[model samples]
Target: MTILIIAQLTIQETQRRRILWLGLLMAISFLAVFGIGLHYIVAELDAIDMDRENMEIATGLLLSAGLYVVNFLIIMMTVLTSVTAISGEIDSHTIDTILTKPVRRWEVVLGKWLGFVGLLIVYVALLSGGLMLVFYLRTGFTISNVLAGSSMMILQGLAVLS
Candidate 1:
């Protein structure tokens, strides 16, 4: 219960700082750009009478590239948010207040870490799923093994985060 309270507070603090909001705003815009670009690319591909085989190749490359970019952003954001949450509190002397409480230091740290981990998971799901959905809607091509791909990406993120 204490850990959960701390975790909730940590999330609220980041929201109060506008970190999560800004990250989400940026991600939405990124998806919008990808969607627009995909629209144009698909139109051109159809206009050129591209065969299904070549079309699949083109779409596959685009999805792979987009997925890679999302993965990279996830790793970067995890690092950035982690640094800001930890060192920012320290520099602002907010950590002093947290430590003055009844909670253990490890509980404080773990709670904050859990809050960020939750954010990362949501971020990955939204961005990767959004990108793939855009790709499919624009091209009529579904990604093969989405479950496997997303799981791998999540694992990669966890590895980088730790």
Candidate 2:
């Protein structure tokens, strides 16, 4: 299918980008630092007055904060990644090869958009899930609301790209 082809190309293109690896490494480092900081903060809160409601609130807040951080990173990466997807190819004369085929210009544009969207979805999903897991392990709390909020960020990113 056209969708699958576009998705595959996008994934391969993204894989070839040095920025992807750099962003990933930075995300991992940031998550580690965030986990350590959250652990200490939660420990301090526990010492103050450990209550179920307070722990829940703390967990939700931590998850929301982690999601926000990851969302920002994803948006930055997505924007940078997409900036050149089409323009770069055209500039390099590679668009001529594709245009010579049966594909229309709009098809190329839509394909690129779909591919980028797919890449963004996978990247954001993994990062968000990892952040959620880390926050859960650190605080023994899971926040569905925070997860929903983070997903909205991905949707927003898609809207911007479209």
Candidate 3:
């Protein structure tokens, strides 16, 4: 119960941060650039009447590159978001207040970590899935290893989070 409460509070605190909003805006802009560039490239390929085989390969390569960028972004975001979670509270003397609560120290630690991890997981899913959907819509192609690739990205983020 205490852990859950702390987790909820952590989520709320992070949600209220200006950094979160800034990060989101940057992400949207990044996706826009990627999407527009890809659309133009695909249009040029269509003008040349590229064969299906080449198109499929090209689409797959694009997905891989896009996901690679997303992977780095997620990793960086996770690091930045978590860097201040504990230290900030300590500096602000907020840790004193939380320590006086009924919750154990470990509970506080675990709750904050879990809360951030949950948030990052949702973020990764939405960005990756949205990009993949855009790719599919723009070109009737799908990466053969999309599921596996996404899972790996998530794992990589978690690894860095720890």
- Steric clashes per prediction: 0, 0, 0
Q: Write the per-residue lDDT of candidate 3 for residues 22-115, one digit (tens) a residue.
A: 7777778878888898899899889999999998888778877898888888888888888899999999999999999777999999999889
Q: Model 3's lDDT to the true fold?
A: 0.85
For model 2, the superposed segments whose C-alpha errors exceed 4 Å read: none
lDDT of each: 0.82, 0.81, 0.85
**Could you tell me every candidate's TM-score relative to the true structure?**
0.89, 0.89, 0.95
Which structure among the candidates has the greatest lDDT? 3
Model 1 error, position 73 (Å): 1.7
lDDT of 1: 0.82
**What is the lDDT, from 0 to 100, of the residue 60 in candidate 1?**
86
Candidate 2 to truth, TM: 0.89
Q: Cα RMSD (Å) between model 2 and the true structure?
A: 1.8
In model 1, which regions exceed 4 Å deviation? none
23-44 in candidate 2: lDDT tens per residue? 7887888788888888898889
Clashing pairs in 3: none
